[model samples]
Target chain A: MIGRDEVLHVARLARLALAEEEIEPMARELSAVLEHVERIGELDLDGVQPTSHVVASSSKVDVTRALRPDEPRPCLPREVALAQAPAVSDGGFLVPSPQA
Target chain B: MSAEVLALSAAQASAAIGAGELDAGELFSFYRERAEADREAGQEGLNCFTWVAREAPGKAGTRVRETVPHWPDTVRMHESAGSSLAGVPLAVKDLFCTEDAPSQSGSRMLEGYTPPYTASAVARLREAGAPLLAKTNQDEFAMGSSTENSAFGPTLNPWDRTRVPGGSSGGSAAAVAAGLAPWALGTDTGGSIRQPASLCGVVGLKPTYGSVSRYGMIAFASSLDQAGPLTRDVTDAALMLAHMIGRDACDATSLAHPQQIALPSAERLDGVRIGVPAELEPEGSSIEDGVRRCFHRALALAEELGAQVNTDISLPHAPYGLSAYYILAPAEASSNLARFDGVRYGLRAASSSKVEGATDLLDMYTRTRHDGFGREVKRRIMLGTYALSSGYYEAYYGRAQKVRTKIAEDFATAFASVDLIATPTSPGVAFALGEKTADPWSMYLSDYFTVPMSLAGIPAISIPCGLSDEHARAGANGAEANGSGLPVGLQLAGPAFSENKLLDAAHALERAIAFDSTAAHV
Candidate 1:
């Protein structure tokens, strides 16, 4: 079973601050799903190549074909890009200092 | 007039507009009013839409010139002028970015976030003269099997108010089923579109991965996430898919769909080889009795329609699909969702005493995500992070990918003899809201029959097979009479890029089954 410390460790790795009340339940739920997922370990799949993506043989264009000329095209204007940011500085997104 | 308009399929409505029998504006308004009424019905409402566009009377077929920049210049003007859907407004899943609407993706993190440009798929559809009707709700980050994960609140099923509309595309399925919109767009990671479509008794298609461009689609699991259609019928699904597919410069994984999504006209599945995978419904499996009964009945109907039904098929690795998917999807999700930090667009947690030692950038990110994400999203993020972290990567994520390879090989082997494979879209019909919410594994199992296709990146379409027997009996007895029973979906999955063949088979089965879509309860 995945314990509370492990859950908290994963949460920290994921950059999610778990509330004091949510930790225990999160641990329980994680353990439950992990139990189900751990069944994959039962399969003896040695020398089988991993498939990260499935590109159909019948597809006319593969990943390489999706590329156009690497020329600059019209993009979201600076104002439009910054408009949705919760905190914006002069022309960029504002974030807390790393060492603050 | 309103009833007649609502009853018309999206393709029929589009044709009517072209023939001058129906005004585009009138059709749009009709659906908008129904949707609004349904939304306002309180306890009786479906609560499908996250944001409904304001009434745009005569602006139905009027092209939004601003979106033209997003469209590829080559073939844009011609396709826009002469497309199948001539100004039939579309209901979009909130996951797809639309410049005109808030694309929150059903998460508090992006509560009011709107993109500067529309998604390639939505923009293409809009260019085909299908106006944006509304942005439908979904599970937060398209995580949950049921729409209960939506921070906006769960979208109730149109057929039975107490039951869920299977999700993360629940709102799209519910909207189409309830006659709120003629059609809608949905994304499938692991049966987000098909499962919901099955539950709501609508038609959904998850096109081959990369068939429809994923540009501007909020990433869930990049390899698995595919945008597709949820419509009332196979013809409408084809119409939507025709306009939504093609190669896009913005998404590297996007590809040119090999076949034109022709409006399927096949009424008989003559000589079509269909395989019923033994892995789907082995004894002691979770397949519900009612769902299994409907599935067998659909197979029998397929035989009657002259299809060669081959029951001896084994996708041995398919049962492990759910396990692999949980690992792969969340692992990808962990990486994809890292962009949701407080620095950029979206909710930024206020630096307050609530955030313990909230001085640094790390504290801000942690606090923001904690406050922003729902329980399911956080759970997935944590799971993904754990799997991909040191010491666990090889055991969890690496092995999962190899298992995925095996599942894909299984499909390849099965497809060698059979043209298409069939399964029940889900284990059962929509369950009651909160029924499986307490058990995440049970909720994940809701996608049991549908995940393998997603894993193999093949095309699968879910069409209404019939209703669950229990619900049918209840309706018959007038205990909870609604003329319609809970929907059961029959899934037809074909080899990669076999959409044409898959749609044809589904269209044939759909015609033979003739499942009534009218939800009287809504």
Candidate 2:
């Protein structure tokens, strides 16, 4: 069973704030999901390499490098890119100051 | 005649408009009226649309042309002026970025956020002259099987108002099923498209991974995510896909297809060997009796249609697909979603007085995400973070990826002897609203059959095979039941870049089944 400390650690890593009362339930749910997926750990995958993507090119070919030439091109205008920002100042995104 | 116009398939609507039999504006108005009527008349509410474009769509310089310079020159047209899908009114799932409409991705985090640019698929569709109808609802960040995870509200199934329209593309499927629009676009990350299409009785296709560009679609699980068409039938799906595919410099992952894909024109599936995995034999507790009956019925129809059905196939590692997907998808999600901190865009939580000194950036980040994201989103984020964390990475994410390799190898071997593989799109018909919400594991299991295809990065389609009569009998009436009955979907999947073949087989089976359902006016 996953403990409250574990759940809180996960929430912290995920940058989500959990209320004190929500911790027990989150732990229970996460534990259940982990238990369900635990079957993968039991399989014998000796010498098998992990697949990052189904489309990732094989060893003989580096197909990803063949994408369009890396010349400088027109991109999203600064104003348009920043149009959705919740807070912006001096032609840039604004955020709270980092604490000491 | 207006109702007839609204019910026209994407192909029929475009052809009619092009042939001068139907006016584009008139056809758009008919669909808009039906959609508005459906929204207003429902007491429980269909809740299909997040935002409906008030102005009619046409050939125009709508917004960007007025402000941006050199806009027309940068835009590329892959198809000629006379594309088949010209002037078809279509709905887009909120996940895709549309320049004219808000793309909230069914989350409060981006409640009113309109993207600066349209998604590549949306741009291609627009260039082909398909009008934007409305932005449809979905599970917040495409996290849930049912659209119950939508920040606004759940989109009820058109087949039965009391049940769910399977999601995170539920709104798209429900919109098409209810005749609000001829078709809609949906993104699938672990069965978001096919499962909902199965439940709603609409035809949906998830093209091969990287076949369609993911440039402006919101990220869920980066490697596993894909966008596809959810239409009334296979032909419409084929037409929509024709315009929506091609390589884009904006998205490096897009498949290289300088030339347009030519769909197979064969009417018969002669000599086509369809592998039926023994593990998914529709027996035991997980498979519903009605679902099993409909699956076998579909296969039998295929046999009669000249396709050689091979039921002796075994995918030993396929049954473990869902387990691996649950690990890999959430891990990627946790990493992809890290950008939503209360910094660049989206909602920022107002600091509360309860924690007097919690006015720092850390507080803002945590509080914003805590309040903005829905419950299911949070659960997945937590699950993902836990799996990817240092101590548990090898036991969980590492093992999951290894298993994914085994699953992919198994599919490669199966395809060596078989032309395609078949399965029931979902375990059963659409369940009652809120039935599986309480149990997260059960909800995850809903994508059991569909995830294996996503894992293998193959093309798959879900076509309406039949209806669950038992579910129909339990309903109050045919109209209140939404249409004929709850829909059952048959999934046809093929190896990479096999979309044309997959669509051909699905088209043949669709003709043989001839399943029909239409939602009644409330």
Candidate 3:
């Protein structure tokens, strides 16, 4: 079973804040899922390469498709882009200072 | 007239509009009115849509036409000149970003967030004259098997409100099934589109990975993510796909579609070699008897249609697909969802705790995510983080990728002698809401039959084959039981980029099955 400290550690790594009551249940559920997925370790996969993307291995696609020219095309205007930002400064995103 | 319009398939409706039998404006209004009625109907409604547009883009009274009249006219001319879905309004899963519409992706994290641009797939469909009618709800970040993970609320099944419309594309499937929208777009990572389509008794096609550009789709599992249509029939699915596919400059992974998506009309599956993998119904497995019966019956029907049925095919690694998928998908999800940090867009929450400096930023992120994400999303993020951590990376994530390759190779070996592989789209029909939510493993098992094809990145479709023998409880609130059983879906998967042939086979099976889509009423 995955322990509370382990779950808390994972939450910190994933940058999630768990509630006081959520930790135990999260650990239990995570342990259950991990146990199920651990069965994949039984496979004799020696020397087998991992497949990150299937299209790269697909035979139908051309390997040497031409890349788009580095021409500046119409894009979302800066103001429009900044419109969705939670906190905006003068023409850019505003954030807390990095230093103490 | 309203009933007749609602009854028409998307293809038939498009043709009617072209022949002047249906007015595009009036047709759009008709669907909009029904969708609004359904949305407002309280418990009787299938809360499918997250946002419904008042008017289609480029139509009169909208800003698009007000600024550019000739542009709307040009679009109209193109529509009349025979775009596949001529002016048929479309319902999109909220994951596809639409400019100026709240594409929240069914999460509080993005509540009230509108994108500045439209998805490549949505834009292409719109260019083909299928205007945006509404944005449908989905599981938050398209993570959950059932739509219960939607932070807004679960989208109830149109067939039986007591049951879940399988998700994360449940709202798209429910919308199409209930006639809330003529057709809809849904993304399938691990059976999101097909499972929901199966549960709702509609047709869903998950095209080969990268066949349809994923430019504006909210990322879930990038390598496995694919966008496809959830329609009422195979022909309508074919029509929607024809316009949605092509290589796009914006998405490097996308490739040019090899063949045109023809509206399949073949009534026989002659010269087709179908393989039924032994892993589909292993001893003591969760495959429900009703679903298994329907699957075997569909195979029998395929044989009657002159197809060679080979039952000896074995995908030994397929049983491990669900395990590998859970690892790979969430690992990718953890990386993809890192952009949701409380900085640029979406929801931002201040930390409740007093912290100094960089810790303040960290606290803000944790608090925002904790407050923003639903339980399932949080669970996945945690699981993914654990799997990809320094020590566990090779044991979990790396091994899962190798298993994924093995599953793909299994399919390749099976496909060497078979034209198509068939399985039940899901273990069973639409399950009751909250039935599996308490057990995440059970929920994960819901994709048992559908995940292998997804792992292979092959084209697969779910078409309604028959209804289950087990009837919905009498007088399930919001929908009349009518003594009819829930819908069961038969999945047909083919090798990479075999959408045309797969559709042809599904179309043939669809006709032979003769499943009544309108049997269940909301």
Candidates' DockQ values?
0.62, 0.58, 0.58
Instruction: Please give each candidate's TM-score.
Output: 0.95, 0.94, 0.94
lDDT of 2 by residue, B467-515 (tens): 8776762333334443455689999998887887888888888888987
Instruction: Please report the candidate that would top TM-score against the real structure.
Output: 1
Model 1, span B349-448: residue lDDT tens: 8662232354888888898898888988998998899999999999999999898888888888998999999999998888988999888888898898
lDDT comparing candidate 3 with the true structure: 0.85
lDDT digits (tens) for residues B384-454 of candidate 3: 99999999999999999889888888888999999999999999889988999999988888898888899
Task: Please give the distance, in angstroms, between residue B398's alpha carbon in candidate 3 and its true position after superposition.
Answer: 1.4
Error of 3 at B243 (Å): 0.6
Q: List where candidate 2 sits over 4 angstroms from the true fold.
A: A57-62, A66-68, B39-43, B58-82, B281-285, B352-358, B473-484, B517-522
Sort the predicted structures by TM-score, highest score first.
1, 3, 2
Score each candidate by Cα lDDT: 0.85, 0.82, 0.85
